[model samples]
Target: MAKDHIDPVEELRQNTAQPFEQAHAMPPSVYTSDEFLNEELEHIFSKDWFCVGRADALKEPGAYTTCELAGQPVLVIRDRDGELRAMSNVCLHRMSTLLHGNGKTRAIVCPYHAWTYNLDGSLRGAPAMTLNEGFCKDQYQLPQVKCQEWLGWVFITLNADAPDVSDQLAQVEEMIAGYDMTNYTEAFYEEHVWDTNWKVLAENFMESYHLPVCHSGTIGGLSKLEDMICPPGLPAFNYHTILKDEELRIAMAHAKNDRLKGEERRTTYLLAIYPSLLITLTPGYFWYLSLHPKGPGQVLIRFGGGMSNDFADDPDIDQNFADLKALLDDVNVEDRGCTEKVFKGLSSDRAVPGHLSHLERPNYDFAQYLMARINAGRGN
Candidate 1:
């Protein structure tokens, strides 16, 4: 796989023309290989700024949650002092699991050996260590992971040695710099398990070519398909698709107030951060989407969002949330159905890496980024 001589961009350019045609498709093995999936888990997911949840999840002191990322179980907790901590969810003794799920707890007591850990991941007591055999309690704390909070979201990386989240995410940060994402609060959150590779979903999200057909009922008639589509530049990590008010009003009918009439609706934005996080920002609406690979052919998608401050307590917010969820569920179902069917083709012997049209610059960039990382043997 050390395609050192393979110019991935050049290869993509040859197959895709200016208007951009989806030329070269991913090879079959990319989706069905257990080996490649493991590599992605270790190298991409573990080392990247994987989203755990929103900062609001840890709003209360001693609030804790458990989640899995790249096949690794993780414990995220807000300590008594209101500091957030991320640690391996494995017990130091016998390597058993620690926290079971999300809850508020003063401390975590490992069920296996009753080994207890403080909210900050400090080893508090080891009930079974009677020998005192040169073992310091301080040395037995749960292993810590790199973590950071940005724009009201909690992100953690299993690779303690990875680059700073800011550094790795600079391009995306710059692209979304003008938006005030922190102003909103979590108004929606959900998760779905899909039967396709995470990259497939990423590729689909990075482009809008399928929006008209795949999301016709929800967004097609509402958006200026041609105008919203643009070449996603060198962030090589993500892309942005703009939707103006005309389209927004049509898709999100609930947003049809006089304040957003005509030109006022020209401010919808969709951004995909490198690796997995997707954020859609509007005049007063926000949505967060995170995708994670579960196995070779399975990926999990989590949804989160915030609303405008003015409407935080509005009862209509519930209806809006439900509507948005239904819209997304339809889109998800459409994407999953087509992608799973496409997976069968990608797994066929007739497949090979396809080309990218000029419009697929983002997709090409992402493919190149992933390939370069893998070929370089960089992993968590």
Candidate 2:
């Protein structure tokens, strides 16, 4: 006996085509199939504005970080002229990766050979290249990738025609105007690899349907499904609102600011920005997850958050961050357990699409985005 083969693209289009009231989850194959993952890497992630990290992380001139975007090695640096740049990390000589991790350096020197590049990615030195005929060092700079900074975050895209990240997230900026996130400073950052499909982790972040159950001991006690408001997805993002019954403990820990008032003071906004940017905003704090698909069953996550500048300047800021990290870690543990289980369940041959709760509207919209990207790849 064998499982029935399903075409992920068609199944996704059909499932997402149903009305919101009648929608179903995408088939398991969309998450478990290698073919579908490859298609996603090419059509969606590679062609979209993918967030890497905060611009503040590279605040000083000569600061740099290396990361992989859709399996392409990318180097992001701040030049001596104070310009932010993103470019291929591969060495022009023998194709070696030029940098690893993050650091501050005047030049990028390849480990394979002494081939060095200036901070701006211009070829600075090529050891023993004089033997090569017609090899112009001036013409051998690392290929450039499109990069932009929006509201303090750095985003890069492999697609030459992709819309600027600022334009894509313009609505999000307006929606969170009251919070003044641009003035926030990162309090902490961490990276983790989860044993779950990238979409599983993404959809998990989009909906609060699992909060009262999955996150029972942590933030769950502060929330109720009835208090959750599911807003429709925009062309580039989807958001939900959660109203606090009592003033948030974290908010109380910080000094009050007039930036947020009335219901905005008590409401939390959770946004999934298209392909892989997940953000959560409270009156006093903001955090985000920048996700990258490592494979069918692995996702690399960059998780971090910051407090309002006023809050960040508090005398007890260190203590506040410790408490926040503890709470966030507990919540992340719960999410990891749930999503890993979901990934295992998705592997079952009998796994099928399930009806979505009204609260899962963001997940529904995500499926629509996935379908649209897949179809667009085929020019359909």
Candidate 3:
């Protein structure tokens, strides 16, 4: 039977009901169906706290970044008082966008009508509005969106009553506290749109089972499947650890660092924070991807990487990150090819789900998470 005749919700529930040993890849319709994507947008992306980037990127009082979430224009800006705030990026005057990409701006100005707003999103000026008898500058403030900084990452949500980002990730923070991730400074950031579902790229990042084959030309050579530790996932996230090869010295804890001990010093954490933040945090460096779906077959990605403060003073810090960028770029190319190919396969009429390797425990938990969110909305 064609996927059109299949009930996506029922299939999703069955997939989640399976035990880990018997779990299979989610059906292709989950990735290839517009209906499923819409449900996900409603229940997950719109309601959950989504990571945009690092808080430090906007450390300057006037710096701000704009992004779209669930088709809503959102802005994350540092107010003059040095507090980070998230609010509607749309102008109240003509609904024009207040800011364009990322920049340091003293105030939000609308290009269409020159309606100006303060860094806190209050109306500072509006031209040609005094003649209107009902106009109130104080009543026209841009709506506030909930935003929080966790471990230096900036996360925002459209829901007014969503649980706090920090509270949701408390377990993850405790587990990886030895790295002192808050001190890691982001060295670079980039954006890209991939020709695959957001979940495909996320699951690919969640597991090491594919390293030996999918990433053979890059860091795969350094990854040993047996050495990776895959434990059961916590409610809000899933994590796995891999030991670094000694030759990859920067990936291990720096010589001057004493926080990590024994195997912990060399372990690299791969954490997937629901619903779409993927982080690869090592002792000496880190990188992350924050994903939002463009549609069923494409995802908008915010990508960034940086080094530990321990290495920030190294004379070779510049050269060190340059080389790391090259390797990350190559690894990304490999991952893009693999994920896009998988998406293409999912579109085929003969596409079928298959059982997963134990290394993919995170993928299983991810499916459960997706199922729970979508299933919860059926009564509404």
Largest TM-score belongs to which candidate? Answer: 3
How far in Å is the alpha carbon of 339 misplaced in model 3?
A: 0.5
- Tens-place lDDT digits, model 3, residues 254-315: 88889899989889999999999999999999999999999999999999999999998899
In terms of lDDT, the best-performing candidate is 3
Residue 97 lDDT (model 1): 92
Tens-place lDDT per residue, model 1, 48-94, is: 77887788867887787777987788988998888888999999878
Residue 350 of model 3 has an lDDT of 97
Candidate 3 TM-score versus the reference? 0.98
For every model shown, what is its TM-score relative to the native structure? 0.82, 0.96, 0.98
lDDT of each: 0.69, 0.86, 0.92
Residue range with the least summed lDDT across 10 consecutive positions in model 1: 247-256
RMSD of each: 4.8, 1.6, 1.3
Q: Over 4 Å off in model 3, which ranges? A: 1-4
